[model samples]
Target: MKNESQIFGIRAVIEAINSGKTIDKLFIQKGLTGELSKELMDLLKKGNISFSYVPIEKLNRLTRKNHQGVVAHIAPIAFHNLENLTLKVIESGETPLFLILDQLSDVRNFGAIIRTAECTGVHGIIIQKKGGAPVSADTVKTSAGAIFKIPICKVDHIKDAMFYLQASGIQIVAATEKASCPIYDIDLTPPTAIVMGSEGKGISNSVLKITDHMAKLPMYGEIASLNVSVACGVFLYESIRQRL
Candidate 1:
């Protein structure tokens, strides 16, 4: 079975990369060695594209066709360049509201966040190129088509994006349980980028250190943590509330 967004075979994958296709995820059979495979590897390194080494069985499961030890999932949408998008947003005279997902791993959570971010007037969503959920067909379905409405930026590093946002006069606000203040206390009216971490791990310590503010939703239940998507909605709406 052929996935609509998937490209198989080393030559095909390499051609896709050269043609500037955004590879959401790539799977290469372990111990794959050939001249074509080497060419793909070189292209991946040049592009800083990440791939996972998996057993041939995994590759077979991904597709029944001849993959030549490589299979790549093409991103459903083109990713925006962070600097270019940020500059455009600032120049447009809009209070730049951005969402930064720090290696969030769940596809459903990712989709929900995108939907909410779009509904809440987020200018863009920034995610790390690696260690996060890929924007796939499932994401498109789960987001209920909101994924196509908003711009998404994939960066090499979360901290680098934070630094760039800060340099652009945007404040970095991280949502985490480890924060001393509640979400309501933060002033979100300025150009702001809210950072949400993975479901298992809240914001990373290094990331939290650079943020202008850290906030948490007040918890009252026995389960102290909310789902990442739910938490994201609360945080985004609070900004909306404060801005309104």
Candidate 2:
């Protein structure tokens, strides 16, 4: 991790959290606990910060400093609140174009998708705090710095985010292989939010059940699937093409 990308040590992380810093991801040593650490953990949960427990060796790989069982990666960009962003876009009299990523955990893929999103004029990108990729230095590099140009919203649950988007009068367009509809056939010019799924698993069934539209790219190769990032580019650019 780059020096600017992360904060090591428990107290430093706690301070960053207290200051309302945007932490993209957090790692703590397995079985970590001190009176201070417990306090930090409590604040993390109350704030809905996403974190994971990792081996001390993993922490050593990230940094040589005394981490005291916790490390936090600073988000490459400030996170936007989905509800506020959604409403703000509508109030501005522009068609709301959002990209929702469901558990796309590969940092490289996440970065690539954001790069395409920025190119497509996507208004914002939404992801689940726990299941999605961490916005690390590698992610920023892979994104060609597009991460800084876009708003990323980290939500508690993908389904909840979908529901809120629907309620906000945005049509949710999900891309999945299981769907029969072609991507280019959709009405992308509306107030719309497109959902892209994880590299390993497609969007969760709970999320798919609520989608306003489901689309799939035309396939001609023997391989039945496209990479998550490539699929996202196809979806986003098609949305762009339709709008244009």
Candidate 3:
């Protein structure tokens, strides 16, 4: 994920996907109506490629080219398979520490969290293919090259990823705003993966369904919540402290 590059347009993206390149997600103008757009949507659905339907203005901001009302960002690093990574960690006789981003869209926050996860010996990071931040140059700079070292896996859906992790004997602990149990009270020594949500909304409903433990940070101030990255740091460090 260290190298930086730009990928644009619909046909180009489709080719990238077909070529087995890892794409973060595709963005299509919200109101697009035509045969080509329709075909692209069908193709994405069939391939389990996640995409966002955004306003034309959003697409325009990305590039001035005839973009064909579509744009896809390539992930800076190649994503690993969840099953393989989980098995590898277990085979190494290590407690698996994984981080899942439910729908985090902030690039800097994503990078900072990745940096913390890597430093803390997390085994892998799982993020939804859509609605998550793309690993752009900003992310690499924010992480200071940590993104290059850590393993990241993109799943078609976060809920599905959670289920897979749970099946692999990894406990799914959610860092949420709604939980009554503070993160400090949780037992993190088990094979565990902590789930973080976006700044605008906490963990999505689908992901919340499969979480084994729900933990929240203790906040006494007027502010209702901590920044996503700050919350991630607190949760990850707590796990590190417990393991030590």
Say which candidate scores most in lDDT. 1
Q: Single out the weakest 10-residue window by summed lDDT for candidate 1.
A: 1-10
lDDT of 3 by residue, 1-244 (tens): 2233656666777778788887776788878788766777787888777778888888878877778888777777888888888899999999999999988999999899999888888889998776678888889889989999999987877888888888989899999878989999999999999999998988988788789999999989999999999899899999999999
Give every collision pair in model 2.
none
- How high is the lDDT of residue 134 in model 2? 89
- What are the models' TM-scores? 0.93, 0.91, 0.86
> Can you write out model 1's per-residue Cα lDDT over 1-244, one digit (the tens) per residue?
6469999999999999999898998999999998989998998898888889999999999899999899889998999999999999999998999999998999989999999999999999999887899998889999999999999999889999999999999999999999999999999999999999999988889999999999999999999899999999999999999888
Off by over 4 Å in 1: 55-57
Give each prediction's root-mean-square deviation over alpha carbons: 1.7, 2.0, 3.3
lDDT of 1 at 141: 91
Q: Which ten residues in a row have the lowest lDDT in candidate 2?
A: 1-10
Q: By TM-score, is 1 or 3 better?
A: 1
Report how far off residue 128 is in candidate 2 (Å). Answer: 0.7
